[model samples]
Target chain A: MIQGISIYEILTVTTVLFFIGVYGFLTRKNLISMLISVELILNASVVNFVVINKYLYPDMLQGAVYAIFIIAVAAAETALAISIIINLYRQINSVEVKDTEVMKH
Target chain B: MDLSTFLLMRHEIVLLVVILLLIIGEVFIAESKKSSMVHLAVFLFGIHTLIGFLSIDYGSLFGGMFHTNALIQFLKNVLNIGVLILLLQSGDWLQEKIIRVNRGVEFFILLFSSLLGMYFMISAGDFLMFYLGLELSTLPVAALAAYDITKRISSESGIKLILSAALASGVSLFGISMLYATTGSIYFTEISYVITADNLTVLAFILFFTGLAFKISLVPFHFWTADVYEGAPISIASYLSVISKGAAVFILMILLFTVLKPLMHIWENMVYIIAIVTMFIGNLFALRQQNMKRFLAFSSIAQAGFILLGLITGDQLGTATVVYFLLIYIFSNLAAFGVVQAISLETGKEQMKDYEGLYRTNPNLSLIMMLALFSLAGIPPVAGFFGKFFLFTAAASKGYYLLVFLAVVNVTISLYYYLLVVRAMFLRKSDNAIPYFKSKVYMRLGLLITAIGILVIGIYSPIYDYIYELSRNLL
Candidate 1:
């Protein structure tokens, strides 16, 4: 364990961050904002992996490696999301979530 | 360290080669000859499917980061067959619509890339590989979902799918982190050995299951399914509904039955509830759908519910029944979607009303549609009946009698809606029915294959034995 920081403290922070992202995702109106919330959500897990690995099992590198892969995958996912959102914006005048309801039953 | 250890991944290696060859072929092949790419893809993939059936030694690789067994290989072959049928069904659309405008080869490339991802996702022995494979399979389909950029609604669907997928996967990753925190390892075999039913671990499982539920389009997470299916191309929609969902279901079952086995007491109850909720929601919503795509979307969700019935058993019977059901489902769902594709491609009409008096004009397509729907509704003399029967039997064997009774009720409800379409086609009449038209040979072949699969797979009996044998690997 780290000398100055407890694992519980770090985990508590991530729990808050994760739920904050969930709230943002639920309440956000703009597509880009929702995407940002997703990034926050992903980063929370990324931190959890790193912190948990550092505190609980300093001997193994699996958690750290997993965190790295998550970061890289998150970047790729964000790029893909932005491209799709851009296409949506081009077709419609707005990126607001309300405008995407052309497919209602 | 010898060469043969690597050959266990023959499916991935061969699929990668086919994808690379297709990329090169697209670059050199002239634009006017673009149709050849479709034929090339289908041919190469057909060869891949044939080779996949030839067994390889089952074992682990890369310090057990990757693993393959009889069960995984069988699932991959099932997927290969599904994609082949999809490609055949999609060939005409690519040649006529997509090839004329842009490099048509991309459709194949993206599809193969997604399939490659599913391969890794299912075969993955560790969390890193699993997460990577999951993302790989999903990202391409989002692009495919938005293929028709000209249609504003299509792009809209694309955005919706990507956003939901990202969020769902992120939630799942958090679950993985929790699992790691609880077990201090990401490898499934290792984690299974040390795992215990702690509160934190249960939370992790629930969060992780949200991701699978999203992919499977279980209710509450299924808001995007109907919209996405409505907006995407018919072939792409069918691909999403069957192939990827099948892969997701396989991985969910494998993980639940293996790595999460110690937590069975916890998740069985969870699966019990999810099974009931997904069925009622999927069936109830399916009854009201006017558009064929949305109708099938809801139907597929209900099928996913039924798959969970076998899942709750957590035994060999559950495993065998689910795999067998998936094979039958692929044919039945594809046949239904194939008819939709052929009709939409030719006439650009997708409403239930368009099918009225359809039998008078297009008797053959109507017959295929009726057979497909009957199989879906689990009537006798078709593969879907056998599939549903086995699933109920699997569940009943474990004494989930209430769940089984509810599923039977859902089946009856599902029959009403499925028959609604048949009613429209045969009994109802209309002035402007879809006129007689011959599907391109590839489309015909696709439909013919599905028809034969729906008719013969259940009665054949040996295929079930093979899948049952494979299921023993897990249980």
Candidate 2:
């Protein structure tokens, strides 16, 4: 909630958040953790959208509306993905990507 | 922007109707007729798509956020045909599962819904509509990616796809925000005027390009592609690789030629660098893939790199090249997947080693696989060869000689791996090879359609002329 911060600061924070998500995605072994990383990345993007919408083009709410749709879609995607992961874990008895190469040539 | 204008194009109206029917089918269709429901949906879509092609009168809708020029309409028709073939090829695979879990109509519903999204995405005239359409196209396919809940790999693929899509969408939105901040407009037409050779605009363009690169699975963003394609079901993998990527290519062509025209110098340079990297990385990875799907996944990435050559030109000829290349790509890629689907069903094996001596057991499939692989490698007398030729020519026309030269080198590298599949089928012999693997009538018919499409389009010049004229008018 820093007031009168420069546009560069907002962009920097957004980039930092995105990098953190990338790191988590790269390092995380658990599938759920990777999914969370994705959520983090998505949020970072929404934050950038909001800040830009407020500061740059207040007239066009398209960015803001798009941000909301991303949230909704991301949530739906997470629900479906998690359910599939749980189902797969039940069948294969493991969630490690290494064990799931059943269809490889 | 008028509501009536929104319904002006026959394809748009048909697309909307199909989407609604799919949603309704999911909610109201009885379990007993679910298989029939899938067929009904496919038939309905086929007819509507044909009508859309036959009734092509160019018009714009919603001010300029939706377009229905002949080129895009033809592209959409090709996509529709591709999806229909996919559905047919998947019928047997889908039938077994639908009966098991009462999934029934839901599968077709989700599929058509995804197609609806892609339709809007290809036709989108503005950033807002484009973004919306992309999400709509993507989210359902993410679900479809993990349709086989019994397999851990299916779930993993689903999760990976969702995470990747989320990141891509988010980053893309941020870029859009930055664009709006700089230009004070979200409409693509207006943004074209606002983008100058400015640092901020260039930054925004880079950010935007990254998001799209993720979708196309270019280098540095392609890690998920092999895994996801390998993990997902064959039908889903084929859909993701051909249909989703095709839609993105259409959008990319439009954006580069129209909206991002002002920043052509900046982005074209970036595209050239990316194209080379993507081709090399894709070919190198593809060579190492023991899994058939992963092999094709990497090959598709390499193909995307080739498509970028057309986009890099940023002209009417480039647009024609991309559109024509995509049409050819649909046939070649889908044929490969169709053969793979046939074999996978027969033997439940997807490894190259499993395909050892496949030629003796299933000569037809082996031949199809050989043709598909050769076409992908740009061997002459195949659709894929012409596709690459057009893409390379378009780039060379832009004085991108180095890029074209590197691309030719990459094509040679790709030929090696594609030949690997041919070698496995012909030279190596499997002890426990599948004997007389038979596909369903629909699948066989579908494969034949795609095969003929590959051959006819390659040998014919009139098709290219038609596509070129359509591109000129549309662009």
Candidate 3:
């Protein structure tokens, strides 16, 4: 445990954040809020990569590089999500998840 | 990399060059001449598919980040063939878009770009490359799903697809991070060397499997499929149902048989239960579907379950059967969707009730639909029967008798629903039946090729032998 901070503690925090993000994603109805929840989930993974790289495999920078790639991908994903939300809003004047169920049985 | 090593990536390079040429043509060509771009794309992809078969070099690049071999070549060529058929069947849709929205170039561009991603994904030797290629392949497909901007369902499908895809990938990335933590490497070979059946690693494996199950539209993760298929354009829907799902299954098989081989005892049980649930749920849901797209969606889900039968064996015969099934599935599913597309384009009707007495008006199209549906139901003498037979044989080889029995029951349940559509088309009579309409030359040719493929692929023994040989070398 470096400086009294253990890897277990960090992983615990990230796991909590990940589940909270999942809860928000399932409960929330707004498109933008769901996107935010997705972002939180992605960020939790990013945190996992950085913490794991620093503590366990400091000899190699591969995890750090992978984390960077994840961040870039999350950015692109967010852009696409926002554009889709805007398109949905234009169609029905609302971005609620329930409003998008026009293809129901 | 050496020059010879670079030559091994010829399929991807050719695809990249074609994409560039399409972009240049989009800018320089006048509005009226743009339809020729579709022809160019098809010609180039055909050449690409032929080249893939000819160039069979086995090698790895970037310290095992990417690998290429005869099996990968075969899979890439299969995808190229699927895409070429998609292009052929999409001519009418493309002409409509060119005349109305003027976005035809963008459609082909997005498709080829997504195909490029699949090429990288099938060849990826490491988790990082796999993740990157996955995102690259999936994002443009969301854009393509929303191609019909005026349709509310189209944009809504885009939203659901991208959001769910993001969540799945995030969960999978977390799993990858855990695997990296435990194994100390992201490359498949390195991971395989150190992987063990510990609790944490097992959990990571399940998480990763869930992500891929979403891609393959397995039971629990398949909520997005029906809606998306119903909303997206028919051409894109077929692409998603066949090409994307096939690529995912291929990569998943590779990862399971190679990187995660050590944890087979755990995954085999998980897959056994999932397969049972997936097959039952898919067929039960398909039985009630009124929309053709939704019906096909559930049917494809059941097909994914059948593919899992082969996955459970994790042997050469298993792999060969899965590949063979997917080849037959590509032709069968596309033929079904092609007929639906032609009918929908002509009449703008998508409901099963509207298809009553179709045989009376459009005998040829209805006949094709019946044959395709019969194949899908695993009737004898069609490609799907042979595909399912081989899959069950592979599973039974592994002593999975109960699972095979359950699968047989599910196949019976599925046949009822498949014949429901056939009954509606051939047996029922309606006063307002769809008129006989001739499709474009390209659509007819596309449908003809897939129809012939469906008819003859089952009787061919050499193809199965060749697939077995390819699967033997996949590892």
Candidate 4:
């Protein structure tokens, strides 16, 4: 039989993972890598949502519904984003964020 | 439903109808006559805005998932006027660029969808309703920010916006879930009743604030703003700056003053810290910007910082100040961007140096720009001054004297950069300056109306009194 850990530990771990993902996103030089890091950050939140829902307000199902919606939206967002990235790569032949930093001071 | 119920729903229904018609019209309109569809959509939307103002009775629906009090109705009208000016100014640019044609109709649809979302978000009484309304407003604007698909930077802007927004939304959702876990309900009014300075509730409030702060592009969450603003087209930037930010501020005010009042001790300190950092960082970045769009981007961010002053107040006076300031800010910022849009259309140049001796070529546009910049800098004889005055007074009344003092100093720093643009336009001379160009009648008329709004609102005090009454009804 598996013994479940405490809810506080779950929340703490999820929060830490989110901050790590945010760090990577801010520090990453490549746009695609940053996007991946963002995905991690979003996933961390989904985990927190599921955990919170499991622990509290299980009757409402609002948290679970919200998680589903977020996942669907995230998928759609990534699909559009990746295709745009591919197009940009086709034209510029590079995906490094530094190479695309032309419109700034 | 009774006549009163029907009357209460009119403003939202009108906007919803206009959005549907525009979407359907986009499908059927022939390629050659598509512009006619755009025109018709604008006409319908304008009429919808007039109807929104004509609305007097206030009501809620779907258990307060949506509402339209006098304050919200007035704001919707303000948003309509802002969008109308943006549409008029952007027409020439959109028409000239072949790549951006069909997207114009989609742009309008997405814009109204976001506006509709904002309408509900401002009046949302429950956390679930608020979250839904927020997503409705956010998702489309992210798409609109990257509407110029042909450009690499445009796509980049879209990706950045969506990614950040998703992260912010998810974090905020987690926070909301925590709130539910703590309070045993998701309704904001219920949570407000239960919430206190408890650790769980404070953490939840912080997370929620972070999400909304990203929307407003406040400091620490503002990393994405300049890049996205610089990358997107000018029209989209104008929308992002004026309409989207205005709507977010509206919801923030509502949430802080009403739903989250119990969490004040925790979030008030957070807002105080965020406000100071946002003002400082935004001003520092704006000072170094060369791209006209990026400059405005940071400037708007700093303005967002100042608006946080009202949020820190947590009172009806704070709400009134916010509405009044946003009303004035809409006129000033959009006017400044209108002049920039008009100039960029003729010359395809958007640098400050490119604007050298602009006064010599087109004195009218330059003068309009000067007034706009002055207003943005919170100078006398313009609306921005009055806006800031009310905001500062609101903050001071709450005994936030330190934030008020720092905001005043930040205002001084802001004046320097706004005047820098004026100097570039009027004092400097470039040998290769283009000859004076004629503006489209719509562009000129928009600028004239904005200038008048700035002047009249500053010189007159009645605007404040009227918005105060509206805020009283709102609360």
User: Using Cα atoms with residue i matched to residue i, what is each candidate's TM-score against the true structure?
Assistant: 0.99, 0.92, 0.98, 0.93
Tell me the tens digit of each residue's lDDT in model 2 across A1-105.
358797789889988988898798778877778788878888887887777777777776866776787688778768876777777778877766566565543
CA lDDT, every model vs. true structure:
0.93, 0.82, 0.90, 0.82
Interface RMSD for each of the candidates: 0.7, 2.8, 0.8, 2.5
- Which runs of model 2 end up more than 4 angstroms from their true locations? A1-19, A27-30, A88-105, B1-4, B22-33, B473-475
For model 4, the superposed segments whose C-alpha errors exceed 4 Å read: A1-24, A27-33, B1-9, B98-102, B473-475
Taking the tens digit of each residue's C-alpha lDDT, what string does model 4 give over B282-400?
99889998889999999999999999998898878988899999999999999999999998888889888888888999999999999999999998777888899989999999898
Select the stronger candidate by DockQ from 2 and 4: 2
Q: Alpha-carbon error at B54 in model 4, in Å? A: 1.9
For candidate 4, give the lDDT of residue B214. 90
Q: lDDT (0-100) at residue B330 of candidate 4?
A: 94
Angstrom error of the Cα, residue B30, model 2: value is 5.2
User: After superposition, which runs of candidate 3 have C-alpha atoms over 4 Å from their true positions?
Assistant: none
lDDT of 3 by residue, B366-442 (tens): 98898899888899989899999999999999999999999999999999999999999999999999988899988
- Per-residue alpha-carbon lDDT of candidate 1 for residues B1-475, written as tens digits (9 for 90 to 100): 5987899899999999999999999889888788788889999999999999896989989999899989999999999999999999989999899988875888888999999999999999998998999999999999999999899978988899999999999999999999999999999999999999999999999999888889888877998999999999999999999999999999999999999999999999988998899999999999899999999999999999999999999989999999999999999999999999999999999998889999999999999999999999999999999999999999999899999999999999999999999999999989888989999999999999999999999899999998898898762
Candidate 2 lDDT over B18-72, as tens digits, reads: 7678778766877666666656666777787677667655777767878777778
Q: Which stretches of candidate 1 lie over 4 Å from their true place?
A: none
- Identify the CAPRI category of the predicted complex in candidate 1: high
**CAPRI docking class of candidate 4:** acceptable
Model 4 chain B weakest lDDT span, ten residues long:
B94-103
Candidate ranking under lDDT, highest first, comes to 1, 3, 2, 4
